[model samples]
Target: MQANYVFRVTVQLDPPTAHLDPDRFETVCRLPAATPGTDGWLFFQYNLWRGDIADADHMQSLLMEKLGVEVIEASFSELETDSAYRAALESEIETDLSRFNADSVDAVVHQHLGSSIHVRDAEAIPDA
Candidate 1:
C-alpha cells in the first residue's frame, strides 16, 4: 500500500571544484540550505514514501548523482499525517497529492526535493 511520508534530509557537500566556475570552493565543502539555520546547515523536507522510501544511504547517493556533491551527514524522521498536519503542509508546501504515489525513494526524492519544507515520517494512526 502507498502512503504519504515526511522526510527530513540534511547533507554536507563540497562545491564542484572541477567545474571551472570561479565560484567553486578550494577545499571546504558547501551545505546549501534553501533556508539555512544559524549554524548554516541546509535542511530539506519532502513528502516521501515508507515501504519504498530511500534510506539515508540511498539519499546520499542520489544527491551525489544528481547534484555532484558528496553527502556527509543524512538522517530520516517520520512526520504525522493528521488533519492538522495535512492542513499545515498544504499551507506550507502546496504539495501535489499525487506525489505520494511515487513507487520508489528515487522517484519521491527526485520529485519533491527543493520544493517542500522539512518533513518527518510517522506511522499511520489506526482508523477508529
Candidate 2:
C-alpha cells in the first residue's frame, strides 16, 4: 500500500556576512518569495511518499547547505491518504525497479525491504 506524505519546511537566512536584499537573494533560491511577516525568510513545501521520508532529510540538508540558510521550522502538513485519492505509486516503483526487472510489487518489496541498515547509539537508536 502507498500513502501521501506532505512536508512543509520553512527556513530563515543568516546571510553569512552582509544582509541580503530579497531581489538579489532570489538568484540563488528558486522560490524567492519572502516569508510573510519577516524578511530573509522563505518556505519550501511539497508532498512525497512515506517511503521517501528518509530521503527528505538529505534534501533538507542539501537545501540548507546550498542556500546558506538555516531551517527554522520543518513539519509534515498532511500524512494520510484515502481511497478517494489514487496515485500511480505502484507504476513509479515498477519504473524504478525496471533496471532490475522486478516483475511485481511483491518482488520489489521482497528484494529491497531488509537492505536498509540502521545503527544504534545511546538515544534514538537502541542497541540490538
What's each prediction's TM-score? 0.25, 0.29
lDDT of 1 by residue, 31-67 (tens): 2332212232112333133332346677667655744
Those runs of model 2 whose alpha carbons end farther than 4 Å from true positions after fitting are 1-5, 15-52, 55-57, 65-68, 78-87, 94-128
Shift in Å, residue 31, candidate 1: 17
Best TM-score among the predictions, by candidate number: 2
Clashing residue pairs in candidate 1 are 33-42, 77-121, 78-120, 78-121, 78-122, 79-120, 79-121, 79-122
lDDT of 2: 0.39
lDDT (C-alpha) at residue 87 in model 1: 45
Task: Rate residue 30 of model 1 by lDDT.
Answer: 25
* Candidate 2 clash pair list: none
**Collision count of model 2:** 0
